[model samples]
Every structure is written in structure tokens, then in C-alpha cells.
Target: MNSGLNFLQTNVNKDFTTLKKNLKKDFTGLKKIKVALLGDSATQFLNQALRACAYEQGFEFEIYEADYNQVSRQLLDLSSDLYQFAPEFVIVFESTQKLQHKFNSLQKSERLQLSELKTEEVKNYYHTLNRQLKAKLIYFNFSEPMDGQFGNYSNKTSFSFLYQVRKLNLELMNLSQECKNLFILDYQALSAHLGRQMAFDAKMFYGASMNLSIDGLPLVAKNCCDIISAINGKFKKCLILDLDNTMWGGIIGDDGIENIEVGDLGNGKAFSDLQQWARQLKQRGIILAVCSKNDEQTAKEPFLKHPEMVLRLDDIAVFVANWNNKADNIRYIQSILNIGFDAMVFLDDNPFERNLVRTNLPEVEVPELPEDPSMYLEYLSALNLFETASYSEEDELRNKHYQQEAGRVIAQKNFTNEDDFLKSLGMTSKVEPVNKFNLPRVAQLSQRSNQFNLRTVRYTEEDVLQISQSENYFTLTFDLKDKFGDNGLICVVVLKKEVSALFIETWLMSCRVLKRGMENFTLNTIVEVAKKNNFKKIQGEYLATSKNGMVKEHYARLGFSEAGQLWELNIENYQTKKSFIQLN
Candidate 1:
């Protein structure tokens, strides 16, 4: 019972019946999130499936289901129940069948304009909802209808329903890029994966007006829950790879670099494709680490010498290749990375290794790779392990930053005094108010940073933008750099001005910058801002979360006096803290 197989059996194989049974499970302590589901077809079953699946994902969904087929009405009307619900997420589901009916009603000339017209309508709905509500919008792209009207010619003709649906899906993706809060769920991908037979029930559509089949409901719910979980800051951040049979065909130590299968060799295409996939993940900020039980030099041979190897040594943030127990090696990697075990995905072909890691560190996600080498990519693709809520320029440079952190670690050993080391690094930071350029990363930090986050208030780009523009709120973003490299936008602070005191609404920093006097620099900066703004006192609070215990005494260490639940600092009495970092 490996974790991969167990995950598939428990979650992917769960049908409507099994999901319904989950509704009875106690959801007392699970995190509660409000969701408003709006659909153009019957969505009672979808609503139930979402709630049940969310429970399994450790979320108790408080869903507000709009009246059947009232997507436009609920969004257009300001005083509607949708607005009253004040959901954190709004899921807009427009069935393909309903979309087809609208297309069929138009003239032949207008048929070609179907996608354009529908895209505008969707944009209107999104803009209307966004203006009224601060909720993140999750819009379902239409699954192409299997109408044999034009047969294979539908792709060739722009007027066909198939063409319109696909074009609409592409337009939705483009729109999502423009709209920061908009998230387009690939319903078309999910439907195609499930196949037309399972995804749609003609009988159910006629009998109950439900477009999604009972068999397909759980998967749809799972995908939706995956998005919700990601937006709420629970998603994979790192991918751990096992060499030999895992990354390539045959063992590196046994087969040798030239003999190992990769690229055009025997069963090489599979391993090559997997490496390419891992490379893409790395490019998108998922830190890549290696944990293998092999002789250090032997494991390094393929990556260094093999022409077919897609991953280079430079691509890997952390490389641990020794005969150490993989569980212990992974623990060491986690220590350096400073990320949660649950936020990492371990991919290894050997069942024994996967099981060992799973048994020792149950929080780490070890997918059960298929026995066959060829099916590796397909199986992993279906799992959708890396679901992200946001991406920015900062994300692209994540691996390089980690590599620089490694450099800083090596540099630290030369100095006995911490202050001397900090000063030697020549640390400088660019402090600026959050604007259009850094809004995405600021919002992303608000969502992704759990360990260092005070108050644990998650914000979307929309929220960050609103705060940035408000007179009552002041925002600060820190970009740190040293002799090693630049740690892009490492810290975010949001301050709210009260009558006399300035309150810290949000204060989060990248853990990589810990013990570098960045905190002292940040506080000194904060005090300067308070004096400039004529604030009498600065107030901060440490809201305890399961992961944020490290910051429990953050205010106390900074010389803030505890005043009941809040920590207060008098600006006039505050002395500047010593910091090696200078403003850039």
C-alpha cells in the first residue's frame, strides 16, 4: 500500500457514492472557507461533491448555491444573495450543453461570432463580480460538446460548435492573465481526461438538467478543491527526485553513464520526458532536490557526463548523493530548504524507497510510480501534483536564490562572529511601497508564506492592489541582495494607520533571510516610517498558527512591550536597532 496507489484508490477512485459518505465525516476542526457556486445548469450534485471532497482535503466548505441557471442574474444584481454570502471564492460553471443551446439560437453569420460574444459576456460577469466582491473568481471553461454536426470538419470551420468552444477556452486563459483574481479551471481538460461517455450523461441532462455525470462529479469536485486549496496557500513547493531507475532507465552505479537509458536509448524517451517535466517545474519556482542512495561520484556521473540528461547539476538546488538512509537525507534537505514536509513531492520508482520515506515522514508526498517505465509521464500528468495560485518574475529566479543561499552558508563558516559575517556579505535591500509591478509577488507572499506570516491573513492580487491604493494603508516590499546574489522581494509589510498608533496588518519575510539582521533592518525601517507619519506608537500582534510558532516572540525580541493581546512600541522611546544591511 504505497502512498501513490493509496492516494489513487482513496481519492481518484472515489465515486459519487463514496464522496457522499464523506459528508457524514466530522469536519469540526477543519479550516472553513466560504464558497458561492453559480451555474447555468443544475449544480446541486456538484455542490454536494465539492463540500464532500473539500472535507477530504481538510476544508469545511460553506457553500452558497445560486438558484438553478441564474449565473447572470446573481452577478448583475448587486443586492442578490450571492453578494450577501460574501464568499472567499466564486465558482462559475457554464455547461457545454447550455452554451450549445445559446449557439444554436444564433444565425449562421452570428455562429462564427459565438466565441467572441460569449467571451465578452464572461468578461462582463467577471468584471461585475470583481467590482462588487473581493472573492477570487474560478470560472470553468466549457468542455467541447461531442456534436457530430460537422464531423471532423469542426476544427477546420470557425462556425462550428467545437471550434467556438475551444476558442472560448483559449480566450478564457488570456483573460485570466489579464484579470489577477480570475482563475480558469480547465474543465475541458478534466472532461477530456474522463472521456465523453463518463463526463456527460444524456439521461441525467434530460431528467435533471445536470450536465456532469455522477461518475464524473468527484473528479470535478477534486479539481475544484485543488484550486481552492492552492489559493489558500496549501500546495507543493518542492519536488525531490531519486536517481537511477527513477530519473532514468537502469541504475547509474550498475549501468554506467553511457549505458544508462535516457534520450534515444532503450526506454530512454520515458526518462527524458520525465526530466523535461521536472525541468519545467524547476523553471516555475518548484525547487528541485536530489536524494539518492548511491556513491556520490557515481550519481554525479550521469548529470555531468551524459549528453542525454535533461537536468544539469546547476538546475538542482540541493544534491545529496551518498549511502545515507534516504529518509535521513531528505530530513537534511528539508532542514536546508526550510519548507514544510507536506509542501514537497518525492518521486522514486522503487516501492521500498517510497514506502520507507512515507513511513518515516508521512507528511512528504511520495507518488507511487507505475512499474512500467513508459507510463511514468502519463501517470504523473493525471495526478496534477503542482497546482499554483499565482506566478511572478520572482518565481522564475527561485532556484538561483536558493543556490545563492547555499553560497551564503559556505561563506558564514569563515567568520566566528555572526555580525562580522553579516557585515562582510555587504547586504543591501530596496524598500518600496507595493505598486503594480510588485503586487503579484506581494499577494503571492501573503498567500504562500505560512511560517513567517503574522496574523496569517491571505490576500489575493485584488486585495493587495486595493490596499496599495488606499490612503488608510501603507505597504512595504523588501528585495535583499548580498555578494552572493539577489533574493527577490524577500519581505512584505502592510501597515494600517489608526487614530494615533500604526498597526501591523501583515508582516512576512522569506525564511532564507533569517539570522541576517534583516529583521533589525526591517524594524528600523518601520520606526523611520512611523516617525515620518507622526504616529505616537506602533502596534503589532503575533497570531499563533500551527506553523508560525517560530515568530511567537518576534515582537518581544524587537523590544516591543506586551500590552495585553497586542505588542506596542513608543516611537519616541524606541532606539534604532543595529543592522548590517543598508538601503539600496
Candidate 2:
């Protein structure tokens, strides 16, 4: 009887153990940040954070980190390789340590290997090669290729030699550019600044049995924080500044502009630091506006003549150097920019001003300013944010870009015809698919782009990779380069192939490039892709969203017929359809 009882107890415990494990697994599935990783160990690092974060949140992550790290020759080819994982974004991290090493290593190699790369364009060559190698290694998350597809597509291709690596990366960059869903994570900048040996004491995954140390990855938690902050920033715009204590020291009207402590020496150091930092913001794509009650010239002189002043007149997107209520100034700034209330950031030195704005413009983001003025530097720097996947040279010229916009408006005043005004602005639009070179920006767009999204499916860098590799999944990204300079990657088109049919899953564009004919160009590219794949019919589903009503008839205009509520277009019929614009 004792032995029988013992046996029953043992079996019951075994069943309980099974139940616990299964419950944990189910809970993990629910909480895991599902990422389909692409590229090098950098991707692995991001996964580690995600895993940790999931555990802490009482969830588990479903991730696929590619065994190889080289990018695909094209995003179109992604459907053939990594698409099975079904990731949220295609995570691509840059390795700063390897860029110089690879370039130097290549330089010492054979002359034949260096044939394709321009010696003078060493930086460009190295970057291109890095993408190729990383993509090859990262494109395949698992050890093997899908059932029957190419296992080592990067290697099987001709001229994949190390010396000829630049050639491979160039092609991969092109491929990624074509895929709209490819999200490239550039941890390189952080690693480059912080050095490769750097690790963080940042928050890690809690309650996780699978202890993957963050030290295994380079930028770790801090970079992850940056990634999060960046995603949160894109949908935001405008900055409202406080006058008396925030911009400078003491009351501006009482102390006088010269008496205001805003210099490199003495107590003015903090104010100078703030000015310089704020000045740099305009260069890095953030808008700055001020609110103060003082004589306009007095409030403006520090920026004009103070030797220690870091900011310039041009940097101020808008400012109210008057006694008027600050909340009113912020409202005016928002109206002038045509931006929404939620996109604004309010900064005040006084509790009164901050609270007033909070009550009135509740949508505006108001991060609590530190009480001690000495901590302002660290406080503001923490909030600068790592938004968008990448920043190009044009990003530095944000003020100039907007200035040109103002010029366009002013030039319009002198011209009677809209066409003539547009023609005078000398606008030029260059539309291209998302590539490895622009993958970071594309991913940034995926995260931040809200208004023009057909379906706002925000993806991280890793999710983009799985989509890129998804069998028959095609992602198309578009760039707008007009007289306003490059708006960078501004539009995206995600295509999913279900057996013989092509499903237009998600199509979105940035509001910045709206009404500029980018949509037509993107539609044209989709038309061409569907024709090439011989998809039975181009189909799209509209779920009747609040913001996507503008696109309600998108497929219909592209020659699609409505089947009940679903839109379907024949490839043959779409081939002949023409819009008012021409695409290359």
C-alpha cells in the first residue's frame, strides 16, 4: 500500500512539473517580443535585451537570429530565405569594430580583390563590403536554409571573395533598399562613440532562466533604450522653451541681456551649454522654439552678440520674445508648422509655466526638468533621443531644409500659378526601393510613420529581416529627393504572396512627402513586381480604418475590381494602367 501510494505521488508530481513548464512556455509566447533577427552578433545582442525585457514583463520572446550575417542581394530575394520566422522588423546592427578592420584587411589582400572598389572611396567601399558580409551571416537566422531554397546564397554567388566583398555588399544594399520592410539597426554610432569594449549596467531581463549575458552584445541596454526612445520620437515635433531660468540665468528683463549669465566663464557655463546643445539640435533634425517675456531685441541679443552663445538666430524655428502667455506661443508655433498638439515638447524653468502648458496643451510631451540647474546638461542630453534608424547629411541641414520650405511659400506669393510656383522651386523627386544603405532610415520610418500608414504595423529592426526573407514577401520602400533635398526613405509597400496570389498587405508613406506623387510611383513598382512574379491577381484588404479612408479606393484606382468588399486587380489589366506621373 505504501509503494502504491508513492507511485501515485510520483506520477502526480510529474504531471505537475509538465503543467508548470507548459504554462511557462505559454506565458513566454504571450509576452515575448517577437523579433526576426538579421545581420551579425549585434542582432544577437538586441535579442538578448528583448529576451530579458520579456522575462521582466512576464512574457517570453520568439526570435530567430540568423546563423550567417550577410544581407540579401535584394529584399525581393528575402522571400526565398528568412521569411519563415515571421519577425516584426528586419534588425540590422552595424559593427563599428569590424569596419576599419575589414577595410585594412582587404587593403592587404590581392590586387584582383580590390578591382571593383575605388581606393579613394575606401570608406564607401568598406561600408558596402560590411553590409554584404554581415547580411550573408545574418540573413539566415538558423543553421540551415529553408527546405529546398539556396542554403548559402551569399557564398554560392560568383565573386564573393573577401577582396571582392565590396561588390557583394553593394548588391545587398540594393536588395535591402528595394524591400520596404527591412529595418536596419545602427548600433555602430553608439559603439563608435562608446568604443567596442563598452558594456552597460543597464536593465536586463528579469525572471528569465535563460541567462544570456548582455556583455555578449556590444551596445546592450543603453542602445536598447536609445532604440525605444527613437521609436517614440518620430511621431513627435516642435519644442517650447521657457525664458527666465531655462534659456539663461536670472530674469532677462531685470538682469539685462549682458547681465544674463550665458558665457563659457563663471556661473554662465550652464546657460552656454544649453545654448550650444540647443543649437546642435537644429542641425540634427529637431525643431526648437522659444517663449519669453522681454524686449524682443534684448531677448535676441545673447544669440546675436554673446561670445559664449552656442545657438544662432537661424536655429530658432519660432519664438515669442513677448510678455504673452507661453501656452499661446506654443499653440501659434504648432499652427504655423501645421503639426498636431501631441508632437510638441514643452520646456520651462518655472513650475507655473510648465503646469500651465500641461493643463492647456495636455498632448504636448513635458519631461520633468531637473530642479537643480547643474543637472540640466545630463537631463536634456538623456532626452535628445535616438530616433529614426539613420541620419543623412540632409539631417544636419534641418533648419535650412525648412528655410527652403519657407522660401517656397514666399515664392508662391509672387507667382499667380501654382504650377509655376512649383516649377520655380526646382523640385526634384527621386524614388527608389529601400536598400541596406538606407535600411536604418526605412526601419525608422516603419516605427515613426503614423499619419499616412494604410495599416500602422510598427516593426523593430528584427521583424523587418523575417519579412525580407519571407517566401514571396516583397517590401518596397520609396525615397523622395526634391529641391527640398532628400526627405530620405519616406514611403513603404509590403507585399505578401499567398500561393499564386499577391496580397498588398501594407502600404504607407510619410506625410512630409505627401501630395508629391510618391504614392503613384510606389504603386507603379508594385504593378511591375506582381507582373514579374506572375501572381494571379493583385489583391488588397481594407478593414475600414479611421485614418486610411484616403486609401479606401487605392486598389480600385490601380485597376482592381471589388469582390464584395475586397479589391482585386488582374495583372494584365494593371500593366496598362497609367497615372499622371512617370516612374523609372
User: By TM-score, how accurate is candidate 2?
Assistant: 0.56
Per-residue lDDT tens digits for candidate 2, residues 268-319, read 7887787777676677777777777777887887778877667777787675
lDDT of each: 0.90, 0.55
Give the number of the best model, judged by TM-score.
1
- Per-residue error for 512 in candidate 1, Å, reads 1.3
What would the TM-scores of all predictions be? 0.96, 0.56
lDDT computed for candidate 1: 0.90
Q: Compared to the true structure, candidate 1 yields what TM-score?
A: 0.96
Q: Tens digit of lDDT per residue, candidate 1, span 164-218?
A: 9989999999998888888998999988877777788999999988889888888
* Shift in Å, residue 388, candidate 1: 0.5
Instruction: Indicate the worst ten consecutive residues by lDDT in candidate 1.
Output: 1-10
Task: Return the lDDT, model 1, position 546.
Answer: 77
